[model samples]
Target: MAKLTIVASIKVKSDQVDFVKSQLENLVPITREEAGCVQYDLHQDNENPAHFLFFEIWESRELWQDHTNNDHIKAYQAATEGMVEEFVLHELTHIA
Candidate 1:
């Protein structure tokens, strides 16, 4: 199976940007250590402080699914609940 690519876009409420960003940053080290994680990078939009993006590459869809079930992920969900304005996720297969 080919590697999986995930693009996650998160838009936080303007007042919650700093708090949400801290929570998002806390996810990086743990996620990078997970199995099948090739790359896990986070970005914040320059012009829009409330916008954040995650570019992740996983070894397989199955492994990425496992990642979604992790404790830290659940904790993140709980911590950021109601703070986000919009959330979007895209899963892609690299083809070339």
Candidate 2:
């Protein structure tokens, strides 16, 4: 099966950027430790401090689904629910 990829673009409130960044940083190690996670990285937009991106790669779609159900992920979602201005999630499959 092809690998699964997720691209999440988040726009945070200007006053909440630092706090949001910190929260996202905490998820990095936890995500990396998940069984089927290949990569889970957080990136900030060079020109826009309020914008951030999550680049995730998983062994399969099933694994990605599992990730969303994980306790830590659930907590993260709840914690950031109202802190973000906008959030977009995109799923992709390896092309080559």
Q: Which candidate comes out best when scored by TM-score? A: 1
Q: In model 1, where do residues sit more than 4 Å from their true spots?
A: none
Off by over 4 Å in 2: none
lDDT of 1 by residue, 11-93 (tens): 99999999999999999999999999999999999999999999999999999999999999999999999999999999999
Question: Relative to the true structure, how large is the alpha-carbon lDDT of every model?
Answer: 0.97, 0.91
Compute each candidate's TM-score over C-alphas.
Answer: 0.98, 0.94
Best by lDDT: 1
TM-score of 1: 0.98
Estimate, for each residue in 23-55, the C-alpha lDDT of model 2 and write its tens digit.
889889998999899999899999999999999
